[model samples]
Target: MTSRNWLTTLAAAALFPMLAHAASEQQLPSEEGQLTVSTVADGLRNPWALAFLPGEQGMLVTERPGNLRVVNAEGKVGPPISGVPKVWAEGQGGLLDVVLSPDFKRDRTVYLSYAEEGEDGKAGTTVGRGQLSQDLARLENFNVIFRQAPKLSEGNHFGSRLVFDREGFLFIALGENNQRPTAQDLDKLQGKIVRILPDGQVPKDNPFFGKTDVRPEIWSFGHRNQQGAALNPWTGKLWTHEHGPRGGDEINIPEPGKNYGWPVATHGINYSMLPIPEAKGKHVDGMVDPHHVWEKSPGISGMAFYDNPRFKAWDHSLFIGALVPQELIRLQLDGDRIVHEERLLGELKARIRDVRVGPDGYVYVLTDAKDGALFKIGLSGG
Candidate 1:
């Protein structure tokens, strides 16, 4: 953490597998080994998400300004693919996460989430899906699948992270739209995680499907801004991390119809240094508590699990990307609990947006900036 150590780490980065952008390689020490953070592609505009396409084609990256494009294996970026919906790109609202269908190889379908503009210029989160054309230049038959209910007039906190479980159910993360109280409102879709079938229909077995006076799509409630979500491949349960108020960021294993107690059971206070009026000091009688809470936030963003043995030391570690601190974090876990935390990529100075572990056994991260980039994280000398 000293200047001399930081400089030494940078000097060591020159030894990574020198791809085209090798000159700017950055390095940092990891508990497992030394990590090489090298740009795989560049010239993107505020990329928010990434998904590897099937058949060795490449990766699909979604930019915040309403563009989706491909970054090929050789680090070549293709033109923006056509047919993406026009986004209400303002104040943290824009095109967001992209993911392939569980049956992508057969269906050639991809899903997209973005901030959709409404009447009076209000915006809210919306999800859609389309089949990628054979030539990769356009999307065909794209249709809106889900939209956040009661769209708010503000733009911040439009959480749009996406994840699909093995059962082919799609889960979408929605933020509370900066309306703090909305997070705990059972009747509202804001600040909730919702699940639907591949075609965007409510599954009959959904926990709240037959309930009254609530959005049937909601799987769980009381989240703030959940920008990171993934399924624990071992347990088949959904795991997510969310941005809390000034502090109190949390990690929760979202279960059916559970109340996460945002605003009511928070360990954080308002950014203005005022105690939240509804907070009951981090616990409420009927709500679930977070498995882990960061009293001093790192501005958590994207996350992914490293289960591959390619890097033995990184096994079972969850890699989290941070924005304000401009770093990547490694959270080592034992069973259901986080056992250790290691911070990396702090010196890179870019808002770490999304992180993904690729089939090739390398971890990929996207940065948030005008000339954002995709980076590959790997160990040196491996």
Candidate 2:
């Protein structure tokens, strides 16, 4: 192993005693059957998100400290890829989500969301796209596609998760920058899910396209810090989740021009345990209710849907990573409703950051820590 990998291995071992041995594997019993948790790669510094590359190219991972690298199928982490944009890299900010273009095979395009520095010490979430070089070592021709307006100075609450709908429209989930009232603002991109064309152009049919007062890219509004997003294959709609203050994390199927309640209709109170200033009640007249709400916040982060045929018990399930509770949550789905909920990996006690269903039909997760690691879950004997 290289020197950096060796150091990371030692760090992971020190942080996670269960992974004391290099290449350790653990078998745990679950409702679906016996499952095996295997370490894929280690020594990632607060790893934020991951995306599986097409075919044999392995995976691309983004570290919160503003580094991006590739990890091979054999679990060897490569050097940091070049040409990453400058990031704010402050508390709860940095290089965030990464995804490939829908036509990656033909276009070689990669999309990234991050905290970017703006004028006079202010910063906000930004989205950009670049083409991957043939060797996968650099991002070529990168350019900013969108930048959140009226940047704030706070270092937290950059809600950034990128997804492409079935029709190939790019949807970006953003946060309110800890500015509570911005969630209700019509002119700013904060606290809203915005849809745009691949090249950063607003779609002519967008809800506010013809309106001069509102930001035309908005698809839906009134959200907190959304860290997870995915396209629901069954419904052809975008599903997203966000962090509430102390409780009340929620999931919503965002629709065009609709207003989902944030500060004005939250089940959660301030972090100080006081009621929110603007909230009138838990339910409001004109606001769209969450599809599902967790009364006790799980500190939810990344999310993915499982529709693979390899595991019958796991199919049609939604896997979400929880940070504060340190577990992977499996929500059994009956169409749009969550019928049952199962918690996985609480014994590990690691802050689960991002969850994704691999192309190989296994569930993969990133642990958020100074010495984080990549883990894969599969059938015990598979």
Candidate 3:
């Protein structure tokens, strides 16, 4: 066998001795049976997000330290690509997410979100678009498309997740920047979901357009640090997950012009263990309730709608990565509601940072660690 195959076989043998016995006995699950997990790529530094190319030859992955690497199907990591913008690189800051444009095959354009340093020593989440060079080893035409206005000094809460809807509109999730009162403010983009054209212009039809009280880009407000956001492929609804203080992590269905109770109303307490008054009722009138809430936070990170057919049973379900719980949580959806949730791969003992369905219909996971790894979940046998 080739060296690469030999190495992979050796690694698999060492990591999962159970595979050997099962393979000999032909006792592996069929295509629709129990899930098997295997490491695909390794030796990464705090890998954050992954985006599959159109043909699935490889994927682009982001590292929190501002590096991007291409991992091929064989689990080989390429040299870091150049032309990434400078980032603040402080606590919970630095490189965040990488996503392909809706027309990636035609345009070769990619979008990135990071915590950028401002002139006055402040840092805020910024989104930029760039084209992959002909050789695919570098980036060109890099330009900042969107930046948080009136950047704040605090680095604690930059939401920085990007997703595109069926209408080709871009939505960016922004946090309160560790300023509790800002969640209630309508003038700033902080603590709000902003909708814009792919090129970053505020859509005139936006809910607050021409309104003096709210920022023109604001679609919804009152969010904490919404680290995870995705477009539900089945319903085209925007779903998001935000980190709460001591407890009360939330999963919300975001709607335009609506307010999601953050500090003003939450099921959670402050980091100091103090209580914030709940919204007048358990479910407020103007605000939306999470489809589900985590009373004990698991430090949720990235989320995506499972669109691949390989796992037919998982269609329309939402997969979220948990940092503290160190597992991948799958929430089954039944007509815009979560019917069930199953936590997978918790025994692997890795902090999952992001989850994506590969073009091949396999589930790919990016783990958070100093020497992080990319893992693939698939059926062992058929």
Local distance difference test scores for all models: 0.86, 0.89, 0.81
For lDDT, the strongest prediction is 2
Per-residue CA lDDT of model 2 for 165-225, tens digit only, reads 8899999999999998899999998899999999999999999998988999999999999
Model 2, residue 321: C-alpha shift (Å): 0.3
Off by over 4 Å in 3: 1-33, 277-282
Cα lDDT of model 1 overall?
A: 0.86
10 residues in a row with least lDDT, candidate 3: 19-28
For residues 1-382, could you state the per-residue lDDT of candidate 3 as single tens digits? Answer: 4566456545643443322222111122322477766777789998988887654347799998999888865677899899989888888888998988999878999899999888888888899999987667988889999998768846679999999999999999988888777887899878889998888899999999999877899999989898999998778889899998778889999888988887777777767776665434346666777768988998999898887544567777788998898888888888887888888777778999999876555577899998998887766531
214-272 per-residue lDDT for model 1 (tens digits) = 88999999899999998886778889999988999999999898999998899899999
Better of 2 and 3 by lDDT: 2
Error of 2 at 168 (Å): 0.9
**Model 1 RMSD to the real structure?**
6.3
